[model samples]
Target: MITQEKYRTTVKELLANGTIKMAIGYRPGSTPDRRRPLFIRTSEEADQLVLDSTCITNLSGYLVTEGLLSDEKQVGIFLRPEGIRSINILAAEYQLNVDQIVIFGFDSTGREVRPLQGRNAGDFSALLTEIKENPPLTSKEPLLERVEKMNAKERFDFWQEEFSRCIKCYACRQACPMCYCRRCIVDSNQPQWINTSSHTLGNFEWNVVRAFHLSGRCVQCGNCDRACPVNIPLRLINQRMAKEVVDGFDHFAGLSPTQEPVLASFKKDDTETFIL
Candidate 1:
């Protein structure tokens, strides 16, 4: 297990050496067991860094925040396995430059905090490959299994019921690293692609559109899931879409920076069973 002191010492060295202009990691939250994102510019602030299972918030979303990375200086970020995948997705989609960010990778599984070796996102290719080849059993959530058992109508009804509680808060959109759009479809009032109201039809449209937008690009970080105030199973929708992309296009999202997004790429021999 990587101790807090070791993590702090490493971050301090990186800061002192001018390897990064800023470091983004976790600090203690309001509650005892909670952790929140912390941005540190000085080596002395390194002591505030902490890593644990509660450090689950994917800080990759902050990487593409407005003017956050505009200074042309290298920025360091503490990343989990999923967060690294988000970085790859961001690079592939041209949202950010992969070379400008330095990764301090760590995996906090169960109660242990393990350090990962990688200066850049591509450095952990082997580890990512291993994870893709052999996913951990714990990766499958029980809620997803239950949802799979429902019939088509039942599933639709389930989603309808869940979406009814939506208040169009847009928290899910804000929390997602892949949803870096300046103007979402629902926000477009010129043509009114989707209704912005929180009524049943509008809510359904918002949720479905959000899911489809993230269909092939989602990194399964569960940030959107946690950000929803209504406790909707947003991650399940993303996981199901990811599974379909894999089975249909043989494409996995964010595996490599060079890989094309599943939805964006088209092939001559692609399957079209759904087409009449």
Candidate 2:
């Protein structure tokens, strides 16, 4: 494994040599329990850059948000797969301008560079395909078959019960790499998409709406679940969306940023026969 000191040294060298103005890496927290993203603006702070498992928050969440140091500058995200999908979804949603971001991302194997996850890897689409035939819920054609078995009222009630423990901390949204907006619809005061109170209804409404918005783009990074204070399985919705985006569009975000979004670009042959 790369030593922390060596990692910092690498950042310094990159600062002197690379086109990147800022490198968003991580540093060992004061203790074992904390490791936060280190924003190195100068060569001196390059010594602070570190990377570890505890560097858990999806770094891409900051891309269009705080991630971008400024609009006039270019930024690079140290992505794996999760960040790619989120940024791709953001680009498709017009939340991000793709040209402004650079892909300093590498593969799990540290292979050659390309867009999204890696240039060569598939969406693990084969993995989703293998599971599609035998989904977790039941022996159904689609897991949604089992999911939809519950009526809207039942679905609403179920989410209410599931998110009842929510603290309205926005940890899920904050951790979501794809949840980038100067101001989220939920946070807008003029329209107030959802109430600010941390009541059950408000939580449920926000959760469901956000999940639906991410339906065709989420890459199942599971950062939101990891970030959750109460451990909500928000990835269920993301995994559900990933499966749907693949099944419907044969496209998966994060697999390749160069590829177009399924919703934004469609073919004449795209499916229209509802199995209902």
Off by over 4 Å in 2: 3-7, 66-72, 91-158, 189-193, 267-269, 273-276
Off by over 4 Å in 1: 137-141
Candidate lDDT scores, in order, read 0.86, 0.64
Error of 2 at 135 (Å): 14
| Residues 1-276 of candidate 1: C-alpha lDDT, one tens digit per residue | 256678788788888998788989999999978888999898778878888877888999999988978887889999988899899999998888988899988886578888898879899888888877775553456877877998999988988999999999999999999989998888889999788889988999988999999998887888988899998888888988888887888777778877887778899999888899
TM-score, model 1 to reference: 0.95
RMSD (CA, Å), each prediction: 1.5, 6.0
Candidate 2 clash pair list: 62-67, 85-254
CA displacement after TM-score superposition, residue 32 of candidate 1 (Å): 1.7
For all predicted structures, in order, the TM-scores are: 0.95, 0.72
